[model samples]
Target chain A: GIQVEQSPPDLILQEGANSTLRCNFSDSVNNLQWFHQNPWGQLINLFYIPSGTKQNGRLSATTVATERYSLLYISSSQTTDSGVYFCAVNGFSGGYNKLIFGAGTRLAVHP
Target chain B: EPEVTQTPSHQVTQMGQEVILRCVPISNHLYFYWYRQILGQKVEFLVSFYNNEISEKSEIFDDQFSVERPDGSNFTLKIRSTKLEDSAMYFCASRTRRTSNEKLFFGSGTQLSVL
Candidate 1:
């Protein structure tokens, strides 16, 4: 099984601030996805980048497959962005068949 | 857009009682999964079902746990006998079978509290 590790277990930011969250995996991943768990406990798929960079609204993500790492960037953050961000990965082996999640990075955006 | 939906947003049950969590996955998705998260803990995978049978499952999904795709739209996770530790947020997810990769659509989740 591949291990997914996310950094900065907790973060607090004021509105308009920016932050970057990182995830590292122990093995090669066939696919990688990022999710935001809002205050209401709804997991929204933010990014599905197996490799390369992508952006949506105020959020962007980049996955360096060769390095086994990925990053999620929140730009000019708003209070609505407050929630837990999760990075999940599926490796090239049997472990890659199912997505395994990280411990999550909890973000609190204060107005 | 179409999304996964779960019923009984919150549930409180007694230990040792049978409880079934229901979900309606995206109409076109082929892979279904059940996951749980204890408060302040990492989300854990329980089981994965495909083709009307379980394809893989974690150790946490033991004898007491079972999954069923009883119909075209409904997927269910049944816990035969619950335990106090079972109290957590349960999430249901589904993904379509794309040739390369697919993103999973997750339901809002069920907050189950076992007493």
Candidate 2:
């Protein structure tokens, strides 16, 4: 099984600031996704960047497959951005597209 | 955009009771999955279904659990005997294809509380 580890398990930022979260996987992956779990516990899909980079509004993600790592950038963060950000990947070993998730980086933005 | 929908947003059951959580994935999606997140824990995969059969399941998905696509539109997860540890937020997800580029969408999730 592949291992996914996220850094800065806890993050605190003031509104309008920027932040970056990192995820490192122990093996190559065929699919990668970023999600934001809101206070209500809804897992909102942010990006599906298995490799390369993608941007969606104030959120952007870049995955360097060769390095087996991904970075999520939140620009001009707002108070509503407070939640847990997760990075999940489907490794080749998991033939059925099973996504293994990291523990997540809990983000808090204060006004 | 179409999205996955789950019913009974919240469920409460006594230990040893039988419980079923239902989900309606996007009509066009072919792959369906069930994931669970215990409080303060990472989301863990339970099982994946395609073509009306389970493709893969994690160790956590034991004899106590079962999945069924009883109809063309509904996917259900049945717990024969619920336990206190079974309490968690269960999420249902779907993807249009098995290709790596196909994005997976998740439902709002059902909060289960086993007493």
In order, the Cα lDDT scores of the candidates are 0.90, 0.94
Model 2 steric clash pairs = none
Taking the candidates one at a time, how many backbone clashes does each contain?
1, 0
Best by DockQ: 2
Tens-digit lDDT track for model 2 on A1-111?
899999999999999999999999999988899999999899999998999999989989999999999999999999999999999988876477778899999999999
Off by over 4 Å in 2: none
DockQ of each: 0.55, 0.72
What TM value does model 1 have? 0.95
lDDT of 2 by residue, B55-77 (tens): 98999999999999998999999
Identify the candidate with maximal lDDT.
Answer: 2
Among all windows of 10 consecutive residues in model 2 chain A, the one with the lowest summed lDDT is: A90-99
**Every model: Cα RMSD to truth:** 1.5, 1.1
